[model samples]
Target: MTCVRPRRAARRTSRSANDSTALQALARAGYVASGVLHLLLGWLAVRLAFGSSGGNADQQGALRELADAPGGALLLWLTAVGFAGLALWQLTEAVAGVPGTDKAKQVGARAKAAAKAVLYGVLAGTAVRVATGSSGGGSEEGLTADLMRAPAGRWLVAVVGLVIVGVGVFHVVKGWRKSFRDDLRATGGGGVGQAVVRLGQVGYMAKGIALGVLGGLFVAAAVTADPEKAGGLDDALRTIREQPFGVVLLVATGLGIAAYGVYSFARARYARL
Candidate 1:
């Protein structure tokens, strides 16, 4: 019994160490992957803004662009691992809950963490698929079309749209209030820190606006009963192009997204991991 207990203790210690190392590595890599994606998306959006056909300015497009670069497949694999790690980390947070918070707050935080886990997990899977050269066609549009064909699918699509809009509003509020600062270990005082904060503010608002527009498209799809009207980030940006002074708006928004990418790099450095 004594020998068995010691062996179990040693195993537990080793497992804990491995977990810590894995979490730290994943957190850093995940942030970098996210930064790269945002940077690519911003670049594509900017090109589109300038009347250049840079192709889709979304996650899938970002992956495809990365694949075209040297050592792209390897990078995608790394990104996939990083995002998978991030998903696991978020899942851990969801399961363990944040430290030193009230019940309600903890529940909310955990829920958010769970949602993030799903997002990262899906992104990781997509990256893996792209890396493997087995990526298929427009899944989002097809999914929307399928949903619309279901009974009461229009209402379901509308609900999804409303939820997305709500999430966009949340991001806008988070930026406006600078509440995201809470997620950081430190936001130094002075010009550099203040600049970073401003960048975050603009980035968040821009992203929020884009999401809001995307949600509106979904709602429109539901109303028109035309799944073709609904789209993702790329489509959302294109819709923005159809508006007045859209190119200018797109360029500004794209710059904001690029700023967010910079902020993401900063986050990798100072995030409360």
Candidate 2:
């Protein structure tokens, strides 16, 4: 049947994508690119903690930082390609469930892979835009404005906020439980191995806290119908700076993010791919 042939071809393409060595390499590179972005974001957060208002402190800010550096354009292009490959890999995983897993686990794994695919796809698009010298898109406020303009948009925004909050909490739980280790090939060797575990815990917690704040802001925006309340990661950090003992807290958070960056590098090497 016509439908059967198409299905078979789709399966074949999925198999090819799953087994591609070049794609595996690129996915690793995507992790490295992620590391670079997180490190920059952490540094920017620390600077913000110190009352320095030099950078944006989010994904876009990280890209801008890279763009300002020497040979940044080439690096950005490579990073975009890497993230695209990662997105493709995850997409394949989402379409074709992992082999030899129980049904429940397979469902969970596929859903997670689908989420990762979306995340990497967005990053790839952003990187490409930055590399192309395009500007003025992807601002948190801008996104909020657009979202709120739709019918039942306030409710929609609220649901999105809730999902983000849920995701943040999931990250916290995952870090606390050390479940991320399941994704790795090996923890590490000796002290380095132990260090990776610690880094992952701290890093996940830090990012989770930040995401929690960001999600809270979105919920606030929805409730107040004020787009200004919703913001990106840099805005989240800036908000943290306004809290009691925020200076020290923000510094700690920055260090934790940097730790995550380092752990990401280890992941680039040890991830199950």
Candidate 3:
């Protein structure tokens, strides 16, 4: 009994350390890193809208841009650490669930936290790869091509497309309903808060549209048995550029994305960490 007591006490101490203020600060910084990434992507898209296609406007592109900045590698390392911390924090949330919730709500909260952990974990891995002078792997199209070559690959691709679309819809709903406010600690009331809300709404809507278009492309690729048709965010944006008044649309979307980035910064500041 004495041994068991000591062991339990040690575990409690470790848990408390993990939940330390420093770790929370690092997690918040991870949000900032994410915000910066979105800002870069938005800027790249804006440039593309203006017919300046100098680079790819995706995660890799954002990392590459970061690499070119002063102390870029160091920043990447810090970002990696921050994201990893966030992943760990989310994982803990997933395991613990939300307090005072019913079983179903608790399950839902845990699932959402698990999803966030995976997302942050991927970003952390990408940041590490960037820091190590390694190029990120193949395009989304290449992955789709590989999958389409397998048995029932087309069906799998379609399912994936549907999932993406669903995620896009969720983002739209969250933004429109301002459900994200629940995660925030304090949103300054009055003009500032209203402006922040507008940015989030616009940003989320733009992201949803982009994701919806990307999913549609994937579905088209599956239907046609042409993996080439499936692409990522950059491809989706390009497809938008091909539409009537596409330039205007793309510019608006780019601005919306930038607004989302701004909203992310606000999240970093007010998030209920």
Best by TM-score: 2
lDDT of 3 by residue, 160-262 (tens): 9988888889888988898877878878999999888888888888888888888988999999999999998889999989999998998888888888889
Best by lDDT: 2
lDDT of 3: 0.84
lDDT of 1 by residue, 91-113 (tens): 77776665556887988988988
Off-target runs (Cα >4 Å) in candidate 1 are 1-19
- The runs of at least 3 residues in candidate 3 whose Cα sits more than 4 Å from the true structure, single-residue gaps closed, are 1-19, 99-101
Q: Go through the candidates in order and give the clash count of each.
A: 0, 0, 0
Which has the better TM-score: candidate 2, or candidate 3?
2
lDDT tens string, model 2, 33-105? Answer: 8888889888888988998888788888888889888999998998898789889888888877765558879
TM-score, per-candidate, Cα-based: 0.90, 0.94, 0.89
Give the higher-lDDT candidate: 1 or 3. Answer: 1
Clashing pairs in 2: none
> Of models 2 and 3, which has the larger lDDT?
2
Candidate 3: how many backbone clashes? 0
Worst 10 residues of 2 by lDDT: 92-101
